[model samples]
Target chain A: MSHEIPIDDGYLDMDLLRFTTAGSVDDGKSTLIGRLLYDSKNTFEDQIEAVEATSKKRGDEHVNLALLTDGLRAEREQGITIDVAYRYFATPKRKFIIADTPGHIQYTRNMVTGASTANLAIILIDARTGVIEQTCRHAFIADLLRIRHVIVAVNKMDLVEHSEERFNEIVAQFKEFASRLNNIVDMTPIPISALHGDNVVDKSTNMDWYEGPTLLYHLENVYIGSDQNHVDARFPVQWVIRPHSDEHHDFRGYAGRVAGGVFKPGDDVIVQPSGFTTKIKAIEGFKGQESEAFAPLSCTITLEDEIDISRGDMISKPNNPPKKDQLIEAMICWFSEDSQLSPRSKYILRHTTNEVKAVVQEVRYKVNINTLHKIEDDKTFTLNEIGRVSIRTSAPLLFDSYRRNRTTGSFVLIDAQTNETVAAGMIV
Target chain B: MEEERHSYQVNHLAQLESEAIFILRETAAQFERPALLFSGGKDSIVMAHLARKAFHPAKLPFPLLHVDTGHNFPETMEYRDRYVAELKADLKVGLVQDSIDQGRVQEEKGPLASRNALQTVTLLDSIEEHQYDACLGGGRRDEEKARAKERFFSHRDDFGQWDPKKQRPELWNIFNGRKHHGENFRVFPLSNWTEMDVWQYIKAEEIPLPNLYFSHDREIVHRNGAMLATSDVVVPQPGEKVETRTVRFRTIGDMTCTGAVDSDASDLDSIIQEVATARQTERGTRSDDKRSETAMEDRKKEGYF
Candidate 1:
């Protein structure tokens, strides 16, 4: 019965970030995540007495903290934030996970499904409407989802009074429209006030002439550790344990999750579209072996020479491999609200733990996302559209280049007759 | 930004236990009647300890289901029968008093009566009596506000409901779990966990739980500001009084609307220091999410987990 408990293990040195915000219900982005979870105490007291009794039964004169991350019931009777919600918060250094997408111009496939596993991207911008067009379509969907750390924020800044010349004219008009976002890699900007809690989670005593670092200290100091791809190894095989047991008879192993570089225990690897190689033999880890395993560690390995890997195989690193393809080209994002993208259509694409049977074959242009241009005459694609297509598949995929590996460069499509998930590719 | 960029990172509870062991090995390589919904709670005993590290030496390729709500807490039925007989795994219960003596549900009647929404008709009648195309749950999109619009692969139809405006858009850790023809799929590999990352991953996986989550004395009954626990399915009205007190629960659901609190903070590092200074919300002492404000989005659009 050890009672002293001040609780240390300091959350085992806390590390996890995952960002993605976007804007539109008046760009406060749910009042900057309800002022960073109510000034970082992580909002409670019966969720602020049920958002102050639904902001005093909607007569509302304050206390709206975007009615605390809005949620369902037709988005709290339509105040907005229609889908991607995922909030969570933490502070003694880190643990965030926001995702909160949705910024109207028809949700753009919920901001490309909350910028696919974001390693940062906040966006917001409303400091008295400076970088509009929904802030260049939220920095072009955080640069078409390669999202390597963004932020921009600039929110209300107490309705532009704590100015700093309108926060350096909306951070030089959002770095001249996010300098045509070539896969971001750190943008930053700040100046907050999600309803007078300026510089979010403490710092702006009315902007002491704006000295920076506060949207929770640039989201608890963002480096996003080279946003993953420790250097090409991969992994894909999702499951194949085979215990056909008698206490320990021929165990087999493979399992998955590493999805990119650094894999060890003998390491020669290769397996992909059945290229074969082998070596690893013992990385294991559910509380055992593991001499190494990387990118996103969920171990198991064990090989040494029995190849024939399964669940859409792809163990990698033979000579930095990955890119087997079968006529691809990507950059998609449609997300079907009752379907449209034409050409040869087909679908069920999936990728990573692979799935195949894809068709499409051309439509290659769309972009316009708030003038990042290239509309090339509306190449018919519907629901939240963002184009460049060219598909083909029915086999060979194991890839990379969502700017080099966001888990073997992403893929989604599905809808081979309404199995839904419609579109969100990337690879190009 | 340099402790050499926190040296190849990984911590947040080992990247949420390697993204819940990669969505439980992508629900054991995408369903064929998948199950794991179990509720011996601490998020399904840390989702059956990450489904025993997601299929370790095999054996759990499915069954743990539970749905029982026959008002639990006999120390969660002896820790769900000694942890499903120490993970030789495969349990399956489903009762809710056999969906209320087979009328398929109808019991809630009075002084806060609650079969907690009759365990969603015995969990959609045990996923259509096991036609179960994937279930998995320990749902944690930081516990409700309609589970922060959950979706680690959540889709459900052929009647097990949940449509939070037609979900299906989860990208990247790519999870489509395609379905139709008596469809299903709940999945939530602890959808990005956070009840302080499941009490710091059950205090870094020492994971044992059920002594009704520490601090105990019992009796209880303060109501509406919460504390309730006077179980025998919580009967204590007419100007309530039953004291005893030290109390403890903070979410295990259904000993009549689960709500316990007073605490001495027994172990698991003083219950993660009383859940990091608890300010009410582990479902704010959930009396089934205190009835409404879209009560957990109308019990997740009628397919309540």
Candidate 2:
């Protein structure tokens, strides 16, 4: 219950950018993770020893850097990742948390989960197998997740002898196909050898004609500012703090992380649902008192007046409030094992701090991930299938586009009977 | 959009803190009787901090629950009491010793034996006795591969077992805290935080922590490739050498099982430096984790926090 922040020093350089690796069996996602961890000094002696021991036991030819992240026993035995393997490494410039997800078709859910939180999606394309269906599938999901930046890591330059022609061919095909999608912020194709440690965390010497930020540089300096919703001021109350049993009993503050925009203490704000107006009393964090808080920072705030604020409530500017409505048009990814999409299926819709009874009124279409096409005639939605659906909630959902605010614009559907999460939906 | 002396001078750090605070509030509102698990560790301490920030003027909605193994360090217990008392949050202690005495659990014999694995029994009994539907803990995915498989709002069956194969998919930040009768949910707001991320956030946020986290001089003994603290609960084995060593615990758990490394990280920066260069994982020092390949998974399945 102690509200005091830990007396640790130094701030995270916002230069830290999150990226995911996409590739199957031989495409080098694991190698890339291993290489990054190894090259970045993130690999400790014990970890190296563990990997070396595993490699020796397996009787592999060389020290498999990929074993650094193959973490699961099954994955180590099978030589493939089935679940997301999150790895962390930092440079002087920034910190990184790479959601190393499986590239196999069976683990599309894992990829979707990893991509959902990424600012940039790195699609690893084997130079030998250029423009494959899985390549298309990975790209499609990355785009769907609203990932602003895309980096096609054309891996295994060593296999192609670091050929420029092959890289160009893959690049042209990808660019031609991706040009059809209008939402791409920036797409840069880089050729590297994840196995030989080319252009991962450091610049590659094998490719002199190419000049680009080594994989680490791009990740360290990728433009993520535009990814955050700087224009929408949204604060979803996570907790309410009150030090009662004294004169402070009257104190009521809304504590939460700022999802988007800047929250200034004196700014006039409107409480969602109740639509009550108030001014921010204070925004308190470890850096001491501050005037404004932006997305992703956690802070405690005291309102100028006592309000009936609890979780799931939104506090925003009156003039630029999020759309509040019960009829939601969204892209829902089914997650339940037993439940299938059906009209009027009762479920609990969880968005931010709010929970409400909701029904899937319609399943417009399901997208074929491999082909990146919408199956309009499909009657039912299955697990890991991205689809468009219309939902009607018991209470209006205060929201923004999933493109704008990942926090306020996203909702999860839970099966009422078994209490299983049935779907993850992003508001359209 | 910059304003003068706005509410507590909002910044990115404040935003993250606020989000955690909001999630804490939701946990309070969405669950019938929730208890924040206080381990007196860094992560749980941060969890408690956010809980306070969530409801500043009002008392924390729920109480603090600790399933004490009696093998825990005296410092941790003192810090736990001081912290809870300072915030006036009700503290609930469920002792593993009591569970063993009541025959709910059995004690393992031998010098190398630990009561670490037995805490789960006391924890489950406490949950049933107190009727806690939602138990919030500071679990992060980057800590371990199995933990990475967990969802934000992890649903547990009546037996308190986690089916990794049957885990509910978590999308975006929307969490499903709903459960049927007798079922429970374990909520981890820090599921996304990594060890380095947690440390960085802790330092950046200036959160207060116990002195044990920083390097301090303590009576210790060398045993089984780890430094064991010289405590009343854990006696040195026949061949183990007892010595006073300057060490800091990366994690604090049952003293009988928790291990420490030789360190001079008397400050946060030094600790971060040590963590960055740590040869073994924080869990690697945990003797209970060294018991088996799926130790945490098995303990978690039995409703251990």
Candidate 3:
């Protein structure tokens, strides 16, 4: 089966990019992902054959690309996506992970879940229905999650005759609304027709007035290597690897993924909550010794002196330590249907690798996702509601502001009774 | 922009490995009694290798559990024993034969009968008997459409049922493994990995796999547009003729349902190339998924990993 195609060594150097897609109902979100996957040669022939057969059975005119993403039986029967479905594809330049999420009012939690770990977000806008409330809601969620890059794909441009004026009008409307968002570093608007494959993978001949890169080209070339916070070094120790064998009797290494900044051997560090200072004696990679470790890399660090470090403790630079506080304010998106969040409600707050009992002290305000307006009078939060609240924990939590570092500043509230995740929080 | 220039940059494979290791470690730290569900397949082998790397210089914290359907290929069983013995880890087996003997499950009767679906009862019962809180699987989203919508931390009810509509929203790297008594989680560290990524990683890391994955001369019977291996458990029916062909198993499962593809790829590089240019999905060869469009979904909802 081996062919004569030249295999380049550069193929092993491909990087990864994770992005989320959001749009209103019938906004062609799934279609865009399906087309991107199909054009990139990711979709298999059997998958297409299944979709084609289903489409013909359901009396569709063409092979419905949207059927590729609607995975669940209910979703396929109803012809809608109700949950976050992850899709994977790769090109010569990069490997892409798309978090294809729903864009309805009831599925805001799905969008937030998809956007939580994304480096970039793609918000689809139908050119016929320029910018609507659903667009604002998606943008607000993307901004609140602190997504750095956003691609405003104005789809269905062929329906509007590929009018540059229409595309510009939609872009202008998006910019007007985006002015209120924070932490949005870049927003690139591309005119595309996902159904017709126009300006999606290749440039469309119908839209000669548009002079922007194609969607696939932009996705492949976008730079996202500098997205992590590399200034404040923080490593939340998840486990302590102790090889009690005679071969390595003295092995006591801290195992964790580097949450923020860079860590190297011989760096002065402090253990959070314990307030003990130590120096890194060595760093262990999967195979051998590593000189340094950066954000998102999982490694083990052996300290110069053992100071009683365990799981849930953090390691950071002594000069710049995360704030340790019991009372913290954060913006939370409610994700529970069994109960509503109110004052005096107790739950288990999981921050980083630490879990502690926390009580809601006060509800400052709730924001209307459609308009991004604050509602100070609403003291109760139900499912899919976003609000700012203060919580007092049983113990002091070592954390940074979500604006500074996403890894250290995010948390989830788990209901101790039902053992279900009730809300997602970002520390302020 | 100038400050973005760094001396080192991790590639996609390295990044994925780190992510999987992180998840594996998190499961070890969070769960009280967890077990790795080993199927002796390529994905499980890759996962077991990652687990070894995650806790170097120390034995695995959890044991490996294999739900035996009594219809596995001999090569897979041989590979399973060798791998487990080399790791020096504990191994537990849940046999479907025992379930049938105890009157806990009934066997299907037909020419196309498979013990694949019957393993669910044995699996859930084993979890109950062992009180395993977390069971790590090698399920990848790219394998099936239902799996694409599954979470890395999939929750199961007290009755051992998965409610696809009521899944908890997983955010960032924070996984909620909290569960009440009798409830458990099915953790998949390789949820984000694709088929190509697995093969590439295996080749890059020089991971060992079963000989069944490689092409070999075997007696096969073409049935229902699929080439099935003629094993002791799978006998050829009347009008079905067995022929010798050079074939390889894309996925290993119950011999009755698992199918083989005719190919000539004998090595890692050749197999990778074959997978890259392959027209059908890995699961397309398996006759189990041909039962219905949502067969995997139905099985998954009933606690099938």
Candidate 4:
């Protein structure tokens, strides 16, 4: 079938929304994503052909949509997702990036990795099973990651004969558990049968009692405009662009993606940790000059006066500079199985564009993800465990609370010996 | 037209571009010696474009490394030369033939034999010879299943092996490029982009590509349901007949494995439209992936880009 490429304007105007899906093996998380892609016309015919062939070879009665997300050979053979697999799809309204993460108990670190940068999280719960411990664990992680939007998709409505009571019960149970957590501002609950194409793309006629929007409808319309920290005004210098050419001689610009807030031409800014103040002369984008630069927009900022600015430096409004501190407290998600986190252990801490040597000053407590309990007695953190810890860096880090600004407030700890990312940290 | 406001909203393409540029700059800053793996493919071209934009007035910090299999489309090589000369960037070629001649790798035998897999050895050898701390690839996760699991800052062992199960967790935008003396990192800036996204970006940015990407009459032969470009490297098997067909390459790999698709998409707009409705993936045409279900994964585990 021939398709027409619309004018570039349509492609240029679309916004991006990144969401994560967390569910146990049988919860149909893959099927939900597959349905979203299939119904949205994102899945190609050849992909369907491949999945169909695989499903038939595996002796499945129906075409298993889960095969779409289970892209790895082992995962496909085992019929389960083991790691975080990113899937892309687009509607006319917006583009989407789905971090389809495994929901097994041992894969908590995988869920965190997927949900960390997600603007929204979709927690799948089987209608027949109601809210299980896995459901609570998923919601807890979503909350811990401070995901602004959460959608509790009560799947398998077809198996439950489209029972509205089952959907309500699961929603109520999830809401009760979610209330105990923090920072999930918008929580939506919808009943869907991913396998039977009900309440996913189009409204399910089987569930007349349900009045909420379809999963696709909610996904397309969700307001993520205010998700970024537009008031903080933080820019972490990633690179210093200097072209030693005759035409553009003496051209020195600080290149970076705006971490937070808005930066306009002529704004008085401070360069940290040097604390040098300067004024922004112009903001250069890839195409040309931009009127203003906001969070996540990569641009080159030319200052009015030449100052010593380099990579790992932060540029912000002089009046509202990021917190410059050597000692910081943050919630840590230990990711490495090779090493455990303990007091006095030194690791390379990367925050924003800056990297510094950091030592664990204190292990405040270990968190029980399922129950959201803080075990104060436990002073050690192993793989897949979340804990609160205080770290002292060799140099000061410019930051804000992760709750205030996810970009600047997050950091990763890398083991020096192996260079493996051992843990993820969110500023408290 | 009214002046576009850059404050209230940022489009998806702009966002993706910004993220990619950020990653490119990060790689340049973190690594002492980094090289952009240029294959003269659409993805690589887009990557080169992004790299140029990342530094703008400044020249790219790293050179461009092309691991040549000695079996290439003439158009691709010419394009590569012109593109590098235009940017005034350093170009390094790691020849598979050189590796074969040096006894570092052996050439495969038979008609379906390709230097596609041998390039991995040449690539690793080149990395060692140049001491490149980081290799920027145009690999996108949406292209292949194994690639979907790759991190933006993927770590490789001293032996240049990728352990899929033991990958470091990549969270937020903080990438850990820290490694020991011998170990290097594989940085994929286009990890988030899809085939459609790449085409759309190319169209929007008006990025120049090899003419092979557009439709033209070429000598091709049908084999295993793919249109293989007729070349000295590809010896046709029994019962396979050559014919002239108007086609374009969806992907640009070694001429031995990369196939062409029958299309009339001679321009950027039409190509975008063709990609939008294409039934198969861009890699589907490549005979290399058709070798086995886990071919890409196996090759990736052994340090294939």
> How big is the positional error of residue A183 in model 3, measured in Å on the Cα after superposition?
1.3
Highest TM-score: which candidate?
3
lDDT of 3 at A264: 85
Better of 1 and 3 by lDDT: 3
- Candidate 4 C-alpha lDDT tens digits along B1-305: 12123345777777888889989999999999999999999999999999998998778889999999989899999999999999989999999989999999889987878889999999999999999989999999998889999999999999999988788788998888888889999999999998888988888777889999999999998888888999898777789988999999999999988899999999988987898788788898988887888899999999999
Ranked by TM-score, top first = 3, 4, 2, 1
Which lDDT tens digits does candidate 4 get at residues A50-83? 8899999999988988788777777787777778
Query: Taking chain A by itself, what TM-score does each prediction score?
Result: 0.38, 0.94, 0.97, 0.96
User: Which whole-number lDDT from 0 to 100 does residue A369 have in model 4?
Assistant: 78
Candidate 1, chain A: TM-score?
A: 0.38
Residue B16 in model 1: lDDT? 79
Task: Compute the interface RMSD for candidate 2.
Answer: 4.6
DockQ-based ranking = 3, 4, 2, 1
Tell me each candidate's i-RMS in Å: 15.8, 4.6, 4.8, 4.5
Q: What's the lDDT for residue A354 in model 4?
A: 86
Between candidates 1 and 2, which one is better according to TM-score?
Answer: 2
Please give me the total number of clashing residue pairs in predicted model 4.
0
Off by over 4 Å in 2: A1-16, A237-244, A275-290, A299-311, B1-19, B197-208
Over B151-224, each residue of candidate 1 has an lDDT whose tens digit, in order, gives 88888888888888888888878888978779888888888888877887777667788988889788888877
TM-score of chain A of 3: 0.97
| Model 3 lDDT tens row, A1-428 | 00111234576557899999999988999899989988788889999999899999999997988888879999898888878999998888898899999867557898899999898999999999999998998999999999999999999998898999999999999999999999899999999999989988988999888888999999998888778888889999999999899988999989988899888889999998999998999887656787788887888899999799989999999999999999999999999878999999999999988999999999999999989889998799999999899999999999999999998999999999888899999999
Judged by DockQ, which candidate is best? Answer: 3
